[model samples]
Target: MDFDKLRESCRKISMPPEMKSRIKTNCKAANADEKQRSRTDGRLVAVCVCCILLLLGIGLTYSGIFERKLPAASDRADASKAENENKFAEILSTAKLTADRIFETTRANIDETEMSSKTQTQSQQSTESTVPEQTTEFVTNPFVFPNGEHAANTGSDDLSYVRPLYLEMSNRENLIIAKEAAETMSQEDFDLFLAENQSMLQGGYFHSMNAGEYLEFTQREWYIPVAPEDMAEICWMYYEPTHEKIDLGMDFSETSKIRFDINETYKADYYYKDSNKYRYEKTIQRDNATIKIYSRRWLYRFENFAWKGYRMDITVCGQEMSAITTEMPLEELEKYLEMIDFVTIKDWLS
Candidate 1:
């Protein structure tokens, strides 16, 4: 009943052939199913491994850690802040460029404006400089005298229209010279005689005395009588010939008065040792035309007394028509001025 007996018994026990073949077939089918399942499980595991690797690669690229290690929260915040700083710097650069452009544009505009203004000013100045100055024209008129006597209008071309009175005065003998000579001779010779016999000097007039024994002497010989009207005309012609009339176009009215100080007007021409000795003044007015008059006074000191002299100037309108200097009083000088025919002169000026 040992091993030999058990082996013999198992060999002697036989089954049907068809049943054994069926069991073998079932075993074969089961082995084939297990191999296919094992192959499917291995393919699934490989596919899962490939998907996981792909997911890891995508995560690293998106998170910006493909080139470096993943950062912590603080490191990520620092990186983001640095990026923001770079963006801010770029924005500031763009803003600065824009400001520079604006400044350049504004400067160019200002420069253009200044240049234009300067050009306008220079043009105006040039135009003003190119303009010409106005000139006055002078014309001559027929000469007339205050006296009723008119100068003969000679047909000769050599004759001047205006006859100067100075020529006539020069041709005649000077009465002042003869009178001076007589006074000087009386003073030299008969001074004591005249002082003792005051009644012998017929008239107090210096010219009345006989200066010396002359071949011929007559009262009318020393006298060249000139009427007041003729004398005024002569004086006027002497100072200013009728041909030389000034048209200064001065504005005047009946009541208007103009006074000129000779000291101020002719500072360089007048000089005197004594400040109070010599003075000259002029006044002017108009009715239909201007009438100007001036008075000059001078005082001279002698051994015991002071001698005073006066001069008068007359003008019809603005023309210097007459002037006279004498030892006459102010009232007498005024009388001479009043004798002038101003209305006639005003008509001539017009």
Candidate 2:
């Protein structure tokens, strides 16, 4: 047969469907095998070449061309082998490109996922940092009356008598009371008294009196005395009529008396005797009682020099007496004493 006729005859000689399917399956299996498997590229190429030669040999023999055109058949088989090798190379190149594209796409997806996760974590941390911290306040009243009740509410008004009393007792007038009391006692008795109350003497302040003494003053008929229950109210009315109440718990007994004393001496040069310029005095005349108030600017040498301060003394004739000292001005001091109602002995007697 001629070359063209022989080639056409080879093409017409078809393999069985089973054989074709088996060849496709083997190729796919080889490609899909583990990288470490014994199957290599060189081995796969040799197998393909052998399969092509076998098919050509079978076709030439079946067509009766093997014996008559042996050399020509050999040449055609070599050409078919070269063509198969080229097709296999092309398939391998296409597969490699597809694998590289898949790897790039997968890497990009992984990177994006990781970046998104990091950003979310940072955002949560920032939110936590911006959040504010939480705080607390404590308020207390320290004045208590002899009856175990709070002195904060004892007065008619909201002001407590403790602050004013404390201020007044801290003055040089305390020394005057001490001197007057000293005059009544003999030197020996005075020394004994000082020895007995050494703690209070050294403390630069007077010891508190008992409930009996406090009651004695309050029960007096000559002047109006503030009842323990009304002490806070009265003091409040006198001072800070419009201000809020601040009850600083002062240590005192219900029957505690109003006493004053000082450890150091005060000179006359320190006294501001100008009653009008340095003092605020007022008289509140009631139907049956007259309330007299005298608040004066007093100076004491607490440190190196004289420090100006105020003292308030209240007297209800034939009724009662109350006094306080403070570093506040006369105007402010007046607020603390104005609300007190002085009742005379005649009024109480009636």
Best by TM-score: 2
Pick by lDDT: which candidate is best?
A: 2
TM-score of every candidate: 0.19, 0.23
What TM-score does model 1 achieve against the real structure?
0.19
lDDT digits (tens) for residues 1-350 of candidate 2: 49999899899999999999999999888767855365677688899999999999898779886466445866865764554455434433543553354335434544553454445445645777432121000011222332345433432212332222232233234434444556666443443443333222222321122111221111111111122332221121111223332221121124221121222221111122233553455766655355554442221111111112333343444453433334345565455334333332232223
RMSD of each: 48.1, 46.0
13, model 2: CA deviation in Å? 99
Error of 1 at 213 (Å): 99
Stretches off by above 4 angstroms in model 1 are: 1-16, 35-350
Q: How accurate is candidate 2 locally (lDDT)?
A: 0.36
Enumerate clash totals for all models, in the order shown.
Answer: 0, 29
